[model samples]
Target: MAPQKAAQEFVGHKLLDREGNNVGRIEQIYFDDRTDKPTWVSVQTGMLGRRHSLVPLQGARVNEGDLMVPFDKERIKDAPDLDVDRHLSVEEENRLYRHYGVQVPGPRRGMQDQGDAQGRHAAGAAEETGMAGRATGEHGTDTRAANARAMNAEAADARTAEADTRSGRGRADAMADEDITMVRSEEQAHVGVESRESGRAHVRKSVDTEHFEQDVPVSHEEIHVERVPLTDEDRATAGNAQIGEEDEEIILHAERAVVAKETKPVEKVRISKEKVTDVQHVEGELRKEHVEVDREADHLTEDDYRGRRRPPAG
Candidate 1:
């Protein structure tokens, strides 16, 4: 593994093959979730229009200009795909290591000592160490040691907080500000009618009522119907017993003959309206604080009678 540098720095760096030929660029970087360290550098290498292959970063050399690896462009491009879900199984890791002649580092191997981790607390410890030495013991050496330990603990806390902020765990509190709303409306209709009659007075009464309500959409149509009536000659023949050539009769009622019919409007349909609205908001606040944990730090002062003070009551 390379030194801990920002992942963005190596995003577009060039990768070289063992035969001194130019490969492709670094398409992506893969990190080990358990240790929060980059474990693989997925280099894309191939010809102009062909499928690129992902080469692992294990045992790859970091030259001054670019990353150097034992396998050339062709071999790297032809390497079997790396399924991140099954990222280089133990056996596969070993086989690739042997094939490329690279040594894979052991797991994270955290800091060997708490004292060493003190360097990580730079931001937080700076706040408390400046307090008055009156809280310390008469012995300067003891006071200095306690101060140093307090600083280290503060620094560790700061580092942990920084990690949480970067990993998106610290934004949980801010997510509570989001708001939601719902609106609904409905309508109903009803009708009632009553009637009464009296037999002795010979009186009668009637009641009528009509009610309608709809939440449906409107539709329209056209309707037409054919109408016909008896002709003048037919009506006159029906009224008279005999008919003469000179006889003339006239029909008072108007009549129509059957012909093509075109319908314009056939039925009535209901119509309704509805309105909906949605509001979105990005709500949240992000905050972080450093909490110090001093494992080996204390203050001591002399009393008027006993040369040393006792511990504070819980």
Candidate 2:
């Protein structure tokens, strides 16, 4: 049998999961009718002890000054909800035991039974709750601690097996005496996003000569002397007019290319994002575990696993 602790020794003790995650704290303790020892604890689970749950106190320990449970948080959160304010019936107790997979204490043919006080663990959570806890069992005890340690180890092993199964890495070696080593490989893919200028263009100017020819009529001064029969009017003007003592000059004009500079928008390349769906052909070698049975191993009768050797989980 495990050591017994006073009802006050349990109140306000922090409850921790196997992975050291805080589930809650003990708000009350429920004693067994026959043993008069704490059989169940009312755990105030949510923030500030707002929610309550009843957990079996069997095989539990104040290991290293903390109450470490064998199960995880999700399991405790999903346990059957029981109100600690009301009486805990024999039916309720049996259900709790079954839910926790605990073998209910069998009937002792000649054991004495005690009457329960109010049959509940707590009156109200807000009631004053903590006390200085001292060990109640025999001092210098080792058997119960060893049993609890074994139970904890079994529970941890079961959890690890379950996790391995879920992660698709079932145990390579299941035999107790067999040595095994598992090698696993994983591939990581990284994708990134950013905006940058792939190419750039701007309005720029540079001068270059080209053969640009066009039919353009231009006027220029040219010296031309033509002899023609004098008309009556030209003769009369030449005879009446005197020779002018002045210099004669002519001006020449020709077409030339003229350049001008101005700014104007001709085309635009607006930047925007469009979500496009495309398949990326990522190639890599994947590894899978291949179970191979040794062909040359000698066959021998193995011990039958009775499943009773595992200690009761806390």
Candidate 3:
């Protein structure tokens, strides 16, 4: 793995964990005061980028266009809430340290080493006093006194060191216990509609009769047998003609009105809905305190005595 670039180049870069999970984008970068190196980053998260989170930049480096961190997405997002618009306060820094369980480098670390050396010297001096005090009783008394003095000094230093640690921890706890009261009030509106009969509609259907006409073709036949032809030629051909039996045949066809029924669709009916908007006046009452001032009470005393200010009547 290569070392990451500076914050300027790391800006606008996405942050991902070792498992390639997206944490957020680097919205800001904060540099440590002593080292002057970027150690914290503000990430823009949540929907619409409305939420911003602070995350440690330890083990984070720019890989290509993204910044990779060795922390989880949720851990970074749930870090201590501190605004990065200005320098980080001591209380806020301590809070972040406590959240990560990282020990703060004490300014008096060398003092602890000095205290250890002093304790060792005191122990060696007491050992020498014990070895020497085994001789003359009077000298033993003085050496024993010196031994007790060194032992007391070592105990006092130990107590001082312990008190300092407790006091530092107490201050952090006090800051964490600072109380904040937030009062929020809001009004909600309710919109409702009920089903009611607005109006009525009626549909009536009727049938009216009218005259209709049509033409139909009919067929008939007229038959005539000629007797005059026989009468005129009967006298002239009576001598040369002898009549025998004759036969005649006819074929007739007649047409009447043909009637058949047929069905067809003309009109249909149904119910439909349409959306409409309307404004209605709403009425309600609210409770509020109204103050009344009287000029006659201008001379009223501002304070009242707590003990025996007035006697209650029976």
Candidate 4:
């Protein structure tokens, strides 16, 4: 594409070096005073894009939505620092042209044309004044006076034109300087949770001894004796029986309470953990930047100062 088109489209786009390394973003483009074509571009570089550097657009190209210049990233960044607040002087432009190895633009066409017109007009006026002086008697004095006035008039007109040019250039420079931006920032609270050992829990077992009592029914054997008078049948039987000493014995069985010990698991015991979610209120003091308009005109309202309403009162 043409250099003028490229320059127009390069603003706010990413700028890359020949090696495809990103130098910065293109902030503004400058035109040559003679040809009025794109000559230089200001790139926002350094940390957070706080610094701006001027790079030549002589061999620059637009590639994939990026402005690619035929220079190294370091070279572009280290170029000579010049104020971007005013039109570049001839010496400054020459220095930059040398640094970037680009040819300087030729003399301005408008200036050349203006000079030619002024010369023609002066010649015609001088001729007319000479003719008028000769037609009369005072040729020398009248010619000298007419020439002096003509010179003074031309000088005044040149000064006026120069002042107007400077004024217009100053306005353009002010517009370019506005490209510098102010970033208002603020602090934010990033909340999150992490696992940490707040405390611990333990389960243990211990034994305790205690006395117990209960009632049980039991029985034992008892001995009893009885005596009676003998009859006739007993006397008859006694004739055949021999009287001799006799012995009797008996055995008894009874139940008694017995105590024994045994071990068995009656309940389950263990240690475990579970997550319990809860909402907690966190407090912090955050800092932020606030922008306010401080103008010299005390009569200007907020709307007027912001240019949203009428012009400033003063």
Model 4 scores worst on lDDT over the 10 consecutive residues at: 135-144
Colliding pairs, model 1: 121-155, 218-271, 222-264, 222-265, 223-263, 223-264, 223-265, 224-263
Q: Mind giving the per-residue lDDT tens digits that candidate 2 earns over 222-269?
A: 678798898998898878777779888776666655556686878966
Candidate 3, 1-314: lDDT as tens digits: 22235475777878897677887777877876655667677888655565677776667766667988777777666575567688786677668767755565453334667998999988986786665566336664666666666776797799899999999999999899877555554433344555669987677778887777889786766676676445666677677655799787787656678867686888887767786888888776534445554556444454554334677879
lDDT of 4 by residue, 73-160 (tens): 9877767667876887777777877887778666545567889999998898788666666645565456666666677679779989
Estimate candidate 2's alpha-carbon lDDT, on a 0 to 1 scale. 0.65
| lDDT of model 4, residue 16 | 93
Model 2: colliding residue pairs: none
- Give me the runs in candidate 1 sitting further than 4 Å from their true place: 1-4, 58-65, 84-92, 107-314
- What overall lDDT goes with each candidate model? 0.59, 0.65, 0.70, 0.79
**Best candidate (score: TM-score):** 4
> TM-score of each candidate?
0.28, 0.33, 0.35, 0.36
RMSD of each: 30.1, 23.0, 16.6, 20.4
Ranking by lDDT: 4, 3, 2, 1
Residue pairs in clash, model 4: none
Candidate 2 similarity to native, TM-score: 0.33
**Which candidate comes out best when scored by lDDT?**
4
